[model samples]
Target: MRYCSIPCRVVGALLFGSVAANAFAQVGQQSVPLSADDNAEVEHVWRFAQETESRSSLPRAVDANWIENARLGTLKLSGCAAALVSADGLAVTSATCLRSLENWIRPDDSVFVAGTLLEERKLPGLTARQLVEIREFARIEEASEDLETGFEAELIAADDSSTFWEYVWRTYGDVRLVVIPPADVTDFGNEEGVYPRYAIDFALFRVYDGQALPLETESYFAWNDRSPYVRERLFATAFDANTPFTVITLSDTFSYNGTISPPHTTLYGMLDQYYSHGATGAWELTEDWLSGIKENDLATALNFSVVGECAQTGAGLINVDMEILGIAFDNANTEEGTRCVVMSTSGILALLRTVLKAQGVADELAEQALP
Candidate 1:
């Protein structure tokens, strides 16, 4: 995604008083101390956003406790989704998450079981090992319409979730995903016909062992695809209070047009992951409903920035009450800027459905769907 920093003052007017309470009020006065469900989902989304921002802005050390408690899974062999696809022993996540591994592995390498937890943790440091690249069924070019239409990728694993986490911890365990979407699809397209199509904002993939890590819990934002585009106020909190909470007023949708073809391919592949910010966390309005309000401006605004010095990879972008918003995909330090990107809940849901369908597990989940 394109990186440009605007003077905070340019957004000061729109951001003024755009806190969670204010956004909630604008939506409607429900109740303070939101219901249990609301609290979990909302808080999850809020913290995820803050954690992502914090990683971008500073070199905050990863807490061991936080690492131990995060959910662990892998992406489907090609697409950017992460979840425990089966109890019988398969884990799913995104291919991009494992791209580094794909680059190094040799074809003749053999897969071996690492005896679950303790042994698996030591797998990465072993010297007598060879990296193996598993062949996937799809390619990026095949999935896109042109140089711009986004492609879908997936990752498949034979190991269970526990093994997944163990592998992550041993190799690269600190990461997060955040989801953001353009207020309107038109803002993402260009005359070349390259545009941002609607998809999940972000998803998380963490490593684990036999025990399932508690997934980030919070009250989730309800999907409102039909809601008209408006300069709505939104709020997000940092995982650490030392960091300032951000309140954004999405004034107007900005357009981004680019090619998705090798070096550019990685950049193109990441556009969805890159621009997946805004409303990734919990949203609220004040009780009076008059605070944190902004109108769509003609200037068309985009909120994008990197937290200096922080490695926020894999930190959860949560809403208030701690529901999972998405995971942090980039570390600011690596690029001399915040490298975080997010996918939305809807994007995650789609991946979940797709992976489950591929694994033939969706039928079971469908039977237990909540009313």
Candidate 2:
């Protein structure tokens, strides 16, 4: 299926126009704080909760850091910014982030790099590089009425008045933007088998010429791709609404499971619901208890859906570690409410690691640092 409704520009203009007047009126207002009981609930589902008890937490922290570093040169594409995963420049971001980059590049062009933080500077001194394009492990495609889609994108161009030097000195960085490829697909035959069902929906690119590099900072997370198990405590550090660069230990591992599905679709998986304080472009995964449905091997796959008033065509769903889980591509509004559906993360990872390993760059790119 193809999208034939209003163009995104028109929709954005209408949405922004409707909300622009109220932007500052409610700006900086924090969401209602979770009560101690609520906080306990959050802890029950988040990955960070178990870190204090788990010795494996160190490697997971490294993995998080590696994911953040890789995002350096990449544009947040969606409202959610990219994070580094590797010290050498591998980035782990939502698959939806690639949509904007794909829109910006020419279809015939096989290679493109997006410049982040550097877009506003007039300086010819900073150079941009086009690194190899990494194949995405998943894509957002049009789904049938019975099927739902979950994906979203945000484009962040530098404000013209901004300067690279000023950004580097005052904000702990310079930024650049680059273009990458688009990865979207839909359609799986029963014959493909359920145990290894996969989707290719994320793209990889690089950024360079930044000051106060991520490696220089004391803040960062570790990588742990070798062993992924459920109930393993983990942490997530994201830019607070007030301070874009200030890292805070937001949440912990609530619960998790790691068995591959044998066949058939799984249902009722829970994801963590971390509070988002009007974070212009952020998405949350449901609680972990809900995600536990995948523990059984007979379920070869699963799907995600968002319950809200907004349309689902472009919403994004991600893991607590900020890995791209799926994209919102379809929705259904009922007296119960609108439920936006997304493809599952297991599908994407299966395809991504396979392709990355084929090129002999999966591990390196997954652990590379931002240049």
Candidate 3:
């Protein structure tokens, strides 16, 4: 979640915007197409997109505060989608990102989180906690209170069993990790039809804000308590290429929900959406809409990454953030594409426990996995 540095498409554009209303009506909700239907659901869809797109796309407008909060979920990837889990700066993204950087992030060559062929540095002390800043070939003195001190990180945890992940870890050294998680898949296949069915593709990071402290904000996603079931209503944030807000169904039409279920995984995302680079990380959020979460003590998390063709993977997945690795499904009914996949929420939590244990950060993780 690496392409040769195109690591992968961060977020697959969920089937919202454009003709999404029509689709939603067919399966989950009623239609709100611009041509007709003046109702709450339709208006919510229109307004969410209009207001969200207004934040960055349109500078001078009724920019909503919620948009700023939504930004908490958006993390900068080498073009992939990533999510901020802790206000103190812990984030997560698909481990599949490494598959794209198998060539660049190696010990023998210069290492970098290459976003767009940007300037890079070589840090020998770059461990899992963070990236070290080397100046003039010397590790710079870290300020005692500098929260932004670390840039590089170590593989906190990953499916250690996956050969692709282990090989990349040995080579490029896990570029975006502040820590690692064990994994079973790494670049097994990034193609829309060749998604990695066996890979546990999630990874975590501890980020430092510009002020050198944890991000100074009150907006961060809280992990949901249980796994999402099939056909749940999903709401997500989108990248520049899509409408700011996307509303879709969990997609129970296919056999995806049962694909990677287990102690290794559960709860995958399935949807009919568009796949593109700008859409990556678009859905790396909790919930921006009240409609998605019902009034209950344990409301299902509407936040998650949709799987699609990652430019990084050269491919497809409808990732639900850390929940499921995501897989893309295509059929003749392709309005754009047939389906998108995601990881299971419970699966991510299960693996995260292993990640924390391996990183020796188990004691602090209860706080870390929270917003």
Candidate 4:
């Protein structure tokens, strides 16, 4: 992953114009909220706000309600993305993307882990922007002027139409590193884009407001400690220069069990070769867990179809219930196309528990659930 000199949100607004315009024609001015019938099956916290514009531009395969929820918790980084995983500024993203903080990483320091909060190092001049409000208008000038300080606004229009969407963002400047696994775990096998992969591939960080305190926001995703299973429907949220904001559908979740065959074309094609190809494999991994806690293979990776487009690195993979399953760290290629690869939050949870046990921090992960 590469760090960007310019804020990616601004880039997203510039790139979203064409797509947003095209979406305006496909759906009504307003979007339908999540159906009550579906909510009866499973209570969902991801509800569409009245201020959110029609999300026709997002993939139709995913529920727009969940997509809106995902967007609200998303933070645009220099060249990657992160998901707000707790109410108190804790976020999860790909460990690889944190290379942007190389300057702060001392030569003698262990790049592989950050055992405690006292060890969390701040990256000065770095900032993250969260999409706090979305307002649509008949004309750019019609947008409200209630902009607050420290927040930035961007206007996006489709073609020459009077319709426009004003994106309001709250920027956080004091970001610090939290818990991170060793590179050996995050980049396990160093296989980069290969399938049948195993890697932790995730990292944690905290965002602080101007008061130099942990940011407290209600729009955050709770961590899902359980593993994703086969045939499960999931969504990946990320941003890139190509598509500033994206919510890609990931279905047919499976674990790679058989040997890699030749002529692997697309992720779908690779899976089509065998029956019952989905499974989950886990093992015990221990390095230095604070006071040395032992645990089974907490690191888990799930493979899924990259519907429509490949997800950008550091994208958060969220389930239907709006809980975050993991982070998309890499995209593997088959003969046909590319597929998104995700690492479950189990590994991060394991590390957090270890830190809490040894360091005795009660606020670890903002009191979020863990196993």
Among the numbered candidates, top lDDT falls to 4
Residue 305, candidate 4: how far off, in angstroms? 7.1
Candidate 4 wrongly placed segments (more than 4 Å): 1-68, 112-118, 143-146, 242-294, 297-310, 351-367
Q: Report the candidate with higher TM-score, 3 versus 4.
A: 4
| Candidates ranked by lDDT | 4, 3, 2, 1
Task: Output the number of the TM-score-best candidate.
Answer: 4
TM-score of each candidate structure, all chains considered together: 0.30, 0.34, 0.44, 0.67
Model 2: per-residue Cα lDDT over 1-371, one tens digit each? 11111111111000000111110022222222222221121211112223444222222222323333322322232234444433444344434444533344345643333333232222122222211121111222321123112222222212341211101111212333222223322212211111222222344433333432422322222332221222222222222122122111111121113542222133222111112222121223223311332333323234433332212222333233333333443343434344333444444333334322212334443343221
lDDT of each: 0.25, 0.28, 0.31, 0.54
- What is the clash count of model 3? 71
Off by over 4 Å in 1: 1-97, 101-206, 209-252, 255-313, 328-341, 355-371
lDDT of 1 by residue, 66-121 (tens): 22222222222221233332232222232333332333223442221222223222
